[model samples]
Target: MAVHSPTSGPCRSIVVSKLVAPATRRSLENMSRRSGVDLFFSSTLSSAELTDRAAVAVVVPVPHAEDEVMEMVHRIRELAPTILLCGVIDVPDQSLWLFAERNGFNLVSSAGGIGAALSRRLAADDLGVREPIAVLNSSDIAGRLGLLGEFEVEGCSVALWRGGGRLGCLENRCTHSGAKLSEGEVEDGVVTCPRHGSRFDIVSGERVRGPADSDVKHFDVFEREGRVWIVPEP
Candidate 1:
């Protein structure tokens, strides 16, 4: 896997090989142990195409030729491997978050290298996880001063309320189709999705509004070092 920094323009580009070319495939198979390239293999058609796009991205190292990885992904999508590994090699210079969101591909690299340090960190949930740092410190303080009870819940995303000097953490996931409640907007104590118009209580994790039949998860909230923490159940 190749790790890349978030860039302002499209990620680095590479020359994409023709998927049906036989010599290209043979050449790829022959190339071994390169010092400065990202390596990716897949066995699905869709993933292969996606990989192709990733290959020519000169913005980052093209470890695996785009065509080859795509072919691999097309071949293996049905096996459902025991593990799926992704690497975000380097911290993106810009909105790595937005890029992942737009492409629906999670980042896997934190370093820009091709060594063992580039191995995927799939088991650690927080390895590359980045969230919005609360900007309204005063609001958080107010919320904490009021203190809501702690609880565990699950949803598409996490939710918090700006009240009483601290926060009341709520499960931001919607059960219906597992839509992110955080992506929804809050109004009158309800967080409603712009996607399907699903709604829930921002404080209770209850499905007050729906296209969804299930409630979201809630978590215990706390504050330390001027930051809000939600201890979600493992």
Candidate 2:
């Protein structure tokens, strides 16, 4: 299933592998058409000839064996460390999902869920073009002592905290496994991920511990007229 959309530009490219189901392939193709994304469908992960031009790949293993899945993921990661990886599984299971996450696959989801997930990752850069959203009121955030509150800005989850009389805001998703940082404990200007205990400096969004090699996304926060506002991406 090689689809060349007229809208396919250099901005985004996607390679989909191991999706044998005709319906699944067609669904992804339809999504690519609607979103104007470049779509390349391949039969196997190893055979998929991806170049630096490719941005991400959706991998679906035909076999449910844990070993096979792990091997495929390992191969893909070895071949393309910079390319974002997403796994599409037919059934929802905890063990397999955790295996994918622990191996550094950015997202793992059911076949029915991959289209939306891929779309979100593809459009992530468009956040910079959108307007800043007002998250909460300063008065509403004041007097929280340590953890101020959590809010959503333009569909992006954000966590707010105040330490040493200075307010800080960061993307709620943990850099390690996308856990909600708001659910984790905050201490000494660092927030820990509840899932893996990855700590991040709330002020700079820098990773302070293991398992998270990247920094969490930081949002510019400011107060205007008694309200707190956030620029989703900078």
Candidate 3:
């Protein structure tokens, strides 16, 4: 939801972390009074600037190594507001998403469908309700036999599932190298990465074996009236 600010600026403005061009900073600062959220278009923002401001920052994917990402996550948690991650490619693991959610950062996809939705919402300045919305539903017991649900609850796809009394949610990106985790396989409590031979526990989202040491995000799940909801912990 694009939260329209009652004031002149956006409820927040976006600042690309890695894409923090001098001109871009000038532009954001010039209009800082009106803009509320600062979207770090990519993982370009220097560590120093992310935490001091009260504005929300949207971190995108950068070509950073594992240690770099962990450092960024630590800083992100320190600068808590409302984080929306975009364009994340699944690589060796799903640590970025896991760390963000663990630190209370709202994990949203920067992929095609949900990524576009989140970008549009932020552009429009509307943060309605930070709740999860179901997009895809699965009951096909023969072929896949798993529930596929998209979390557009906040303009991004935070896909979730609850089949056979099991519950799981991920950032919609596979940890094996950027494949959509939602499109992956989940059986007997394991979610198989579509790209490679990686499996994650649906309930805990931990990559149990093979190439993925990072954990996928696990949101708070609830069902009512035959509908499922994924709520981020506050």
Question: Ten consecutive residues with minimal summed lDDT in candidate 1?
Answer: 76-85
| Local distance difference test, candidate 3 | 0.50
- Cα deviation of 97, candidate 3, in Å: 22
Which stretches of candidate 1 lie above 4 Å from their native place? 1-157, 163-166
Name the better of 1 and 2 by TM-score. Answer: 2
Candidate 3 deviant stretches above 4 angstroms: 1-144
TM-score of each: 0.31, 0.48, 0.38
lDDT of each residue in 1-234, candidate 3, tens digit only: 133222235344444445433443444344433443433343435444443233444544533464565455545533432344333433435665554443333443433333444445455545432434443333432233465556554544566655544556666766668777777777776777788868876656667887876877666454333445465633
Local accuracy by lDDT, each model: 0.39, 0.66, 0.50
Give a tens-digit lDDT track for model 1, residues 1-234: 233322223342122223323333333233213323333333332333333333322112212333443333323222211112232323344444333212212222333331233222222432222222332344435524222332233332456664422244566556777665555666655667667887765544557767887767654344434555554443
Number of the candidate with higher lDDT, 1 or 2? 2
